[model samples]
Target: MNAGHQTTRRLAAGAGKSICRSCRDSLSRNYASAAAAAVQTEDHVSQHIPPVAQASPQTSYQVNAGVVLSRPPQITRDLHPFESAFFLYQRRLNERSALPFTRYFYYKERTPADREWKRKIKQRLTPARDIGRYKGYGEEAWNDEVLVGAKESDFNWQVERLLEDAETTGVEDQPAQELTETTPSPLAQKKVEHEAVERPMSRITEADKKNDVKSLNRLLQRTLYFLVKNKEGQWMFPQDGLQKETLKEAAHRVLEYSAGVNMNTWIVGNVPIGHYQLDYPTSRKTESGLNELGLKTFFMKARIMAGQANLKENQFGLQDFQWLAKEEVKTQVEDKYWRSIKNMLAER
Candidate 1:
């Protein structure tokens, strides 16, 4: 009872002292932290308050200096009614008179030498043999005959005989002398001259004359029928069909002719007179011979026309005609270009 109890009491006293010391250390730390926080808060307040006061005047002065001067109020005067109307009318007239790129087409047409050269080159290469054959000169077999001063009728006869021989023997390499080159009958010469005079000025060579007429006839017939069918509505030709290089060439010829001129004739139209400011290369062949906006306008019109029109089907269940109308055909040519751009973007 004496020794064990005393030892236990001593251990409890030591533990109590240790707990009190720990509590005192915690209190001291808490007080020190609180003091430091108070000092920091005072410093922050002091710093911010002086800056705010000091900067307020300067900021106010700067803002006041930066203020823009108010502009004077405009006069409330209005134009007279007649003046307004006249101005509007003049503006409209100016707008109507201003053709954007139509002048370029007319200018290009006026200068026919370049087109003639191009046509000649094409004729020299392809020769429009089918047309020549139909005209009585088997293909362009009479090119040399015509060049050699053979009479028109004589050339025609030679062409007919050559075509007949070619058809029968499936060979176009017949001897030149073997093809009869008799003197042309007077009646035949007169007929040839009359037809030649009546023919539209085109890039058509003598060999291509018959073929051009035949092709034109086919196109005209198809166009007429298509138009008749859609007499009550508008129509558009599919651009994809006319987008062929050959067809484009044909279209260019048609356009050239429709503008009231050809490869040999001067341009005759209500051509606008203005300096053409082309944003693109003039030498390059554009879809509608117009800029991006013009092309868009054309396509939109075409889409409207196509939506309103009825599509004609041929005996073979194919579209017999290439272009429905000039506008539609122009649109078809232009739509392909924008669609191509859209496709490229989608891929990216």
Candidate 2:
């Protein structure tokens, strides 16, 4: 062949050698990897086998000792009395209660109609508020002892007024009767004394008195109130939870989270105005991992200095909010909870 043909054959030969070398290197790597895997498999089997099957008894002993030393020891200490009490309280709060450990509400002023409406509502419900089977003995006893007592006092005041009118009329007509018959015996004297003793005193009882004008005047300032609809659809004051926070912090956070009131627009009070217990449905025994059937909720109240409840799109499940008038609140809230709210609003 020619010189060019010879050169072409040499180049082809070099290419074939390079290809063969690459294939050899790949095969060698695969064999080395397979040998390493086989060795690992044997080691694994040896470790899992019984100690008697092992080559050396000392090796098994050493492996067991290493495992024991690798594990860390668990240590615990007993809590202090106060600390234990606090933990117990917190545990109860967790197991028996819903998320919100406390609540805060905002109250403005009240109108004249508001005060009047509250007073009338209280009067209407006072007689039978605790008469239902749902009420406990404590509530029944309180109603009988306190509310019934006040009613009796008012009745006595009216009787006293009637007695005063009778005494006056008797004195005026006594002269005419004296001319007709002059029978003044000790029996008649005793009867008169008896009538006097049975008659009501002229003084007015506390129950008969009205709300002072000054106190009512303070409430009659056309104050607007605010309430929020909870996840349950009950209308209540905007509230939030307390997570290891002070009452004020929790209140402000509640205003922000539930009411969606911006910090710049909203003004909040530092101190809480009132407090109350909120009744919530307890979780089922299976769900709560406890036998308790009730939840203990503690609520607090605070005054909204300024800003309206502008609930945002992502607010805490708050369906809606409103700047409610007194009449609106009376229609919205239940009687028992409203009494506490009315007291807060009508506070002097």
Candidate 3:
């Protein structure tokens, strides 16, 4: 044989030696792996959900599309002690580094708003953002964990205003000569423009005070997940058997079926974020006599936008339900199941 023919034969031998190593070794994996059917069966066995025998073409899992329905944090999370100190340090650094804000640039020499701004600066002014749900005042600038007691009617702004009103009443109640000394005019209140203090509603709602797990208003500062109790009293996320539809379609159907259509929810994506599997105690047979082995649950994330779940009717198989935080959910769900699913949950 010629030199070129010999080189072609050697190349063929090398190719034969390195053939199908990954196909044979299914345990091997990579983050970049776009693994399809070739790696699927081996991974299933590794998961130990159903026996290796059950991975055959005849045996099958009852595929379920689960909705990890959640209410995102209504308020910012509370800072840790270190975080708070660090932020305070950073603020001081910023204060030292920054040039003094020149009043002449933005404001005329003296006006009501400008005077108010000046008076506020003397008291170390902090402007409040008035966004509807996530709003907070000076002292209430972090989490919305407030005491919804009998005293809830006394919001911070109103309390301060009431004190001011009392002081004004004292001044008004004084004799004419004393009033002359105290006030530029008896209508001193008129001089100040009667700055109205609009009392903001307390963040703590009735649902929070009651510690109602069924209600969505419990934790304003933490993500709340939707869970349903099965007929056996096993608590898990709302899920249903997949029909002849896409995973996302099945997830929507499952959410509506298990939790009712009263809620306005948005599924985060079309694909599953996590996978979990569990096998039945006994190997059951399908209608076609193939082994009905176990369950394979595909979790898809969704956020509750407007309404809440109505499990009162119990129209579906579920008997009880709750909107629980991640830690609370871990306590309720099975250890193995929680282990399979915990990584998908929000840290806080």
For TM-score, the strongest prediction is: 3
Over the stretch 1-348, how does candidate 2's per-residue lDDT look in tens digits?
Answer: 543445445555777655565565565566666667888999999999867653532211100000000001112223454554454344333423332222112222354444333333333332122121112235443322223333223434435544543343132224435522433454335333213336533333332264331111222323445566778998776655456767655655666666554423333344555554544354344332444333322344444443444566536687776554466567888786677556555311
Which residue pairs of candidate 3 clash?
none
TM-score of each: 0.14, 0.31, 0.61
TM for candidate 2 is 0.31
How many residue pairs of model 3 clash at the backbone? 0
Model 2 residue 266 distance off true place after TM-score fit, in angstroms = 6.5
Candidate 3 C-alpha lDDT tens digits along 1-348 = 443445445555677866465632332333214344546777877788764454477777889888899999987765665554454445434443332556566677766556545444432323221111222345544543322332322334435544454333333244567545555674653634444556545567788899999888778888999999987899999888888999989888888888878999999988899989999998789888778789999999999998878776645678889999999999999999999999999976
Q: Give the winner by lDDT.
A: 3
Candidate 2 lDDT at 149 equals: 31
List candidate 1 stretches off by more than 4 Å: 1-156, 163-232, 237-348
Residue 335, candidate 2: how far off, in angstroms? 2.2
Task: Give the C-alpha lDDT of model 3.
Answer: 0.69
Backbone clash pairs for candidate 2 read: none
Among residues 3 or more apart in sequence or in different chains, the pairs in candidate 1 whose N, CA or C atoms overlap within 3 Å are: 131-211, 137-159, 138-159, 239-332
Task: For candidate 2, give the lDDT of residue 316.
Answer: 69
TM-score of 3: 0.61
Sort every candidate by lDDT, greatest first.
3, 2, 1
Lowest summed lDDT across 10 adjacent residues in model 3 is found at 126-135
Tell me which of candidates 2 and 3 scores higher on TM-score.
Answer: 3
Off by over 4 Å in 3: 1-56, 86-186, 189-194, 200-203, 312-315
